[model samples]
Target: MYKETLSSGIIIVPMQQEHAEQLEALQRIVFPNLAEEELLHADQYKKHVELFPEGQFVALDGDKVIAATSSIRYHFNLNDNEHHTFFEIMGGGWFTTHEPNGEWLYGMDVSVHPDYRSKGIARALYRARQYTCKQLGLKGQMTVGMLNGYAAVSDQMNIDEYYKKVKNHELFDPTVSVQEKVGFEIVGLMKDYLNDPTCGNAGAVIVLDAGKAI
Candidate 1:
């Protein structure tokens, strides 16, 4: 039950079974574009807590969960050339790929309620993840970041071009931009990372060194 005060009334805590229902509802609200089969259920939450309790975290305003980040450890060879999709890396979305002796922490998802956007909740969750990685002595943290603002400009430029623009600060993507600000660097791009139409079926693989000076 680790807790971190975010503000006068907000805090972050390890996800517990008691937060299952709220977590499910919050996922639906945050990722409404995801297919029904893609959204997590209460039972899944229970499984997550059982598999790796320390890897899951939730942000709250008193008793209400406002944001969450799910993660799992995996044996990732940063030198490997084999490109893996989100489902493949996540073991078909069940996080069954988690390896206790894995070298890196793979962030499965981070969801913040729309109403709470730009409130520093997501940044706080990321800081917690970095702390977890360092404490576990893992190599680092990795995630496929969605390009939340891609759709609007995708037709005018290829994904690669857009990505370059983002890297050069000529473009801004709601999701990737925040990730960059948090110290994550784009490793590459992924296709079919998620079914969400907003991202144009692509995402950016971002990585951050857990032991890097903050």
Candidate 2:
């Protein structure tokens, strides 16, 4: 089993069946604008552990599920031409597309409770994902990060310009910028990525290599 305790006192561990309900509740708190179907309910969380326990993780403050990240192994080459929506990629929360022989760990979701946003919870969760990737001998960790800050500047620029600005360090995106801080890099942008008004329903594909996972 994989586990770690950050300096800030949060515990990171593999997601288990017992954590399902709290995780479901955590999702609502972190992403209030998303539809219920887009969020993984309790049953889906259990299925995630069942399908790929090694690829899923949660961060806890005491016994409360304060943060989590769900992932699946997939073999696709991380490229600019590829495209897929969050719902279709997540298999509607069931993670049915998890390929046992896949070469990459695909992050389906990573969320932190509002009260614990800047306490290193997200960075810890990401490190856990990278640790899992190296353990599985995967090529790297990949995620379609929702452009959570895009909505704030939508009228000022198009998604492409916004992407360049963020990539160039001229803009700060709540989600992507944080991922970059943790050593992931911007590779491409995804449009109509999810039903998220806050992000203009777009996503950015970010990646981190296996050698750098830990």
Candidates in order have lDDT scores of 0.83, 0.88
lDDT, model 1, position 20: 92
Clashing residue pairs, candidate 1?
A: none
Q: Cα RMSD (Å) between model 2 and the true structure?
A: 1.2
Q: What is the lDDT of residue 57 in candidate 1?
A: 95
The C-alpha stretches of model 2 lying farther than 4 A from their native spots are none
State how far residue 172 of model 1 sits from its true place (Å): 1.0
- In model 2, the Cα lDDT at residue 157 comes to 85
Error of 1 at 209 (Å): 0.6
- What are the per-residue Cα lDDT tens digits for candidate 1 across 2-109? 778976467888999999999999989998888766677778887888998878999998899999999999877656535776667766657788898887888989
Off by over 4 Å in 1: none
